[model samples]
Target: MTAEFWNGTMAAAAAAKQARVQVNAAYPITPQTHTVEYLSRFVNDGELDARLCKVESEHSALSACAGAAAVGARAFTASCSQGLALMSEVMYFTSGMRFPVVMAVANRTLSVPVNIWADHQDTLVNRDAGWIQIYTQTVQEIYDLILLAFRIAEHEDVCLPALVAYDGFILSHASEPVHPLDQAAVDAFLPPPGSADRPLLDPARPLQFGEVLFPDWYPDFELKKHRALADSLGTIRKAFEEFEAASGRRYAPVDAFATDGAEMVIVGLGSMMKTARHTAEKLREDGVRVGTAALRVFRPFPAEDLLEAVGGCRTVLVLDRDIGYGTGGMVYPDVTRILYHEDHRPDVLNFIVGTGGKDITPATIERCVELARGGYRGRVEFWPDARGAEEGVPYTEEPAAP
Candidate 1:
């Protein structure tokens, strides 16, 4: 059945409806707070057989997920912004220990003024934490990816954590149509959970999952995690295929729009991307020569696919919702890296926009494209937040004060 513009509150409730989740541990935060509220109602209504863990903080929420997952329970949790940052240190432990837990990150901007709004800073900030991160552009992806995340994360080849992310108020609260799936469909797609391969925990084995190890074997352990992540890419592709084969819904590592035979390309992530797309069509009709690429998979970086899309571009603009603090935008660094190793790399531009959920309209994207072709010669340009951004213009972060 199709979802009728259901809010994120009901979407979260849908999770309990679809998955056989055993424990849900979360601390309330804006935008995503309703997710927990709906999930709690599911637990109370007998629709879901789950233990509602009202933790004191986000740290405890994830900690519970790790513990429960280790002992073989379909654990779930959600958090954002400061909450994700607060659990930053322990995020290492959870993934390093290899627990098949899945989380829904309501992507939000980090704060100095402490604002709660949609942005990828929080999720991008934890990019190297060894989790399989996927961003869904639609509400149905949110519901489906959560279920798919469980299957992919728990696979023996990919014993890692996964984050099913979508922008906060943008995707979370915005009403959109989604195809809701039944519990039986989800079960068939996911298969029976054998994460630990037994009932709960068996004292007979008395295994030690987490322990301090010396440096000699640490490198080997770390290497294995690396291999698993790389291997999981194949498994990820497989899972997407399985989802499409069974559900008739498609997904990709990188979702592109009108990229065929274009001289220039624009890259976008999260909700701002939708705006860029609308402007791109107008630019294309005006014969300005442009294409737009959406980054569906951020963690894996989609290097091979990204290189193919922007391979022949004369100019590229990488729009980011958050600055990389000291650097310009995060995508600029990686884009430049992609070009450096290749024989042909385009003139890449970086603009940090929508830092605190500022409005990013089609006009903003149009202006950006215009400035990009202005014959500026530089690798980086720190746009004046969103309000002062200029397209095709060349500028870099000014030198630090002496």
Candidate 2:
């Protein structure tokens, strides 16, 4: 193990090299640019024995990775926001082909207004694209999960592409001390090249490629894919457990803090949940019963673990960084679905905050808890006094001048 001060981008690049990825197809984009930049340097320095393909666009980046994976090579790529949008079409094809390609997404807000900051909107748009999605809240988790992603995606029971996403700029640029595992340890955890549990395109064994399926057979093919996705939950758990045992860093699909005997629970994803946890601790000091729930694995959804975490609470407050357009925040609907059939589920409130990398401080978290106490009747609630946001001031409190 090696502990060093590293940002998310460096951590991701380092993790990829340690995981022994054979090919990295990349195109520079905000926040995610440093990830590939670091990888390129690693390859140049002869530290990583891999092929780095500098592509023209994000679409071509993922397409190149898919091509490499087709030839039984361990492949990786990184993107954010518009980059993710461009790669969307290829993303579905990669999953449908059952290629175990791993991608790192620096989650950012989508365009039209032309904002490039931290938000979940980009990845949420492709939620049903048949790829496993994992969100990391800290720099350490970013490094650890990217390493684990290869193992989980290449598992025989789940040969699907996976994306490890973290808040753009927030987690991506913020530096922290991470104890990265040595290459030997990672090699032990993952399979070598051409030995992954996925179908390959070797010339020796000529096989039919992804042919157009007739209507009669298409549904069954999709059904089987869906079943594989559902069964991946067990594989995810097993990988996390093994990683924890080897590294002594515990992780879970749904991570809960002080939820046992709490009256109110705040549920969210990414680094904002760390802020919520701090707020929960202060609220507890004030004799308030509060807890925090952070969803790590977004794709598998971890409905059972989520229900177990918040089932005893009197109220569940969902804080989302992305919206679902016509309905409400993306995560809110999922939470409601988990408790939909329960006769005595807690009242759930949804608040969309921190879009486009708006600051979500401890004060903001406190405000959310207070609002939830007063009761909310709306489907989705924005930050209180959101008119200021329309005027370019998203945060209620201004930072003190130096």
Candidate 3:
């Protein structure tokens, strides 16, 4: 293993190369462009033996990857925000066809006002796209999860696409030390491309993909896909265990910090969770029983692990970077639902923060803890107010009550 100073985008690119991806078809987009650019450079320098298919648009990019996966080859791509929106149609096609293509998403805010920065809206909105979603907090997690994504996605029992999402500008641009596994180790961990059992588009033995099915049979296919995704949890955990053995780094679906016997806990995704964890430690110094739980695996939902993490707390404060509009934050409802059926449910609160690249500082987390402790009346509130704040307004001030 060699440790080097690398940004999240570079970490993703390095892992894809190590995985020996056969095809990369992606369009250039902000925050995510660096990943595809690095891959192109690798291919050009002969460092990675792969086909770099430059496409006209994000739609074409994912379509190209789907085609490559259809031929039973390992494929990769990177996109964010609008780029991800453009790939929405092909996203379902890739997953429904059971193609184990891997994609790196630099999570960014979607547009109306046109902003480019870190947020989870892009990936969260596409949560039901049938692709396995894994959110990363640090640059190292980006590298590690990308490699693991390929291994889990291609498992014989779970033939599904997977996405590794990291905060767009925060993790994507920030440089950090990452220990990249040696090529020999990576080769041993992941089988060669096309080794997994998948329906190959062979000339001698033809198979149909995206075939029209009557209503009677359609639900069965959907149910099968759902079951496959749910069963993938075992594959994911096994991959995590094997990777830790090989890399000496451990990962879990839900990462908890100082949650034992806590009265309150902060729950979130992406880079903000690191800050929340730090705030929790500081709060502990002040004799506050606060903890943090970061959701690593967003899709197979990890409902069981999440229940174990925050279920014991008296109050669970869910911090969301993406707003679900009428319903509040994207992740808030999910947390509430997970706890609603439990007999020991806590008082769950949702605070939508850091939307459109706004900063989610330690101060923001402190304020959230304060409000939760004070028994704030609203179930859902926006930090810094969704309505434009006056210039120089502090983030700690409570937003208009929900």
Highest-lDDT candidate: 3
Error of 1 at 120 (Å): 1.5
Tens digits of per-residue lDDT for model 3, 98-190: 898899999999998899998899999899999999999999999999999999999999999999999998999999999999999999999
Off by over 4 Å in 2: 377-380, 388-402
**Could you estimate the TM-score for every candidate?**
0.93, 0.95, 0.96
- Local distance difference test, per candidate? 0.78, 0.88, 0.90
Which candidate would rank higher by TM-score, 1 or 3?
Answer: 3
Candidate 2 lDDT, 102-215, residue by residue in tens: 999999999878888998999999989999999989999999999899999989899999999999999899999999887788878788865875567878888888899999
Q: At residue 194, what lDDT does model 2 achieve?
A: 59
C-alpha displacement of 146 in model 3, angstroms? Answer: 0.1
Q: Identify the runs in model 3 with alpha carbons over 4 angstroms from their true place.
A: 384-402
lDDT of 1 by residue, 1-58 (tens): 6556676545755764577788889999877888898888888988788898999999
Backbone atom clashes (below 3 Å) for every candidate: 7, 0, 0
Candidate number of the best TM-score: 3
